[model samples]
Target: ENFFDFCIHSSGESEIKIKLFFISWHPLIVPIDEIYANETGTLTVCRFYTKGSLKDYIHQTKPTNSAYWKRYGRKSLSRVCDLNQIKNFGRQILEALNFIYDNGLVYGHLHSGNILFDLDQALPIKLLVGFVYNLYF
Candidate 1:
C-alpha cells in the first residue's frame, strides 16, 4: 500500500547498512521514522512512493549502457504525466534543495533514485559516490 505500511509490514526487516536512514530531519528530506532495533541492526525503511523516484517517473527503460545495468535491471515501464506535473515536481525539488542548502547541509548523495517523487518522509542522505550516481543514473 503506502510507504509507511510497506515499512511497517515488511514482516521481519533487520538491517542498518545506510546510516542516514536512521537519523534525519527537514520537510524536504525524508525523515528518520519509527521502528525498533537491537545489536543485530535497524529496520531501514524507505517510504513507498506511488509516484516512485523521479528517475522511475521519467525513464521508460533501465539504462543499457550504464555500469549499474545489473542493479537497475532491464525493464520496460510506462510513465503517466504532463507538462504541468513536471513543472510542479521541479518546483518542489528546488524547494527541497534550497532547504538543504539553506541549513548549510549538503545532500551528500544526490541522484535520481536518491530522489523520491513523494517527499513527505522516507529515505535520506547516503554514501558511495558511485552508489550515489550509480543508484539511479
Candidate 2:
C-alpha cells in the first residue's frame, strides 16, 4: 500500500523501476518485487528491502490555515502507548541496528520518517522503511 517516488539507474545509463512490498517477518525491511532497466544492465536487483531512519515520534499538529481552525481541536493517530510499548520499539530498533552492523553494513540515514508502525494489529508494530542511504561493506 506504498508507492516509492524514486527510481534507480542501471549501468549508469538506463533507469530501473523498482516495486517493493511489505513482508510480515521483519519490521525493519521490505522486499523488491520487480526491477527492469530499459531492457538492459547486469546488476541484478535481488530480494532487497529498505529500512527507515527513525528520528522521533510525537503527536504533530495539522496545519489549518489560521488560529480559528486550530481553536476547534486537533486530531491524532489514536494509538495509546505505554512505557512498555516504547521500550519494545526501542529494543526492536536496536536489534535492527545490531543485525546491520553484524553484516558489516551501516545505516547512512536515520530519521523519524524512516520508522513505520503497522497499526493493523491489536498492538501496533514498528517498521523501518528506507535504505537508499545504507552503506554495505
Best by TM-score: 1
Q: lDDT by residue for model 1 over 1-137, one digit each (tens)?
A: 64333432343234222323422454555555454554333443554445556665466534332454533555635577689776766666667665544543344456677666543534322221111100111
TM-scores of the models, in the order given: 0.44, 0.42
Mind giving the per-residue lDDT tens digits that candidate 2 earns over 1-137?
A: 11122222221223222222222234454334443443222232434222212221243322232352342235433234589877977777677666655543344455555555443444343444334322323
Q: lDDT at 71 for candidate 1? A: 34
Which residue ranges in model 1 land beyond 4 Å of their true spot?
A: 1-24, 34-51, 59-75, 78-80, 119-137
The alpha-carbon RMSD values of the candidates against the true structure, listed in the order shown, are: 12.4, 9.8
Query: Evaluated with lDDT, which candidate comes out highest?
Result: 1
In candidate 2, clashing pairs total: 7
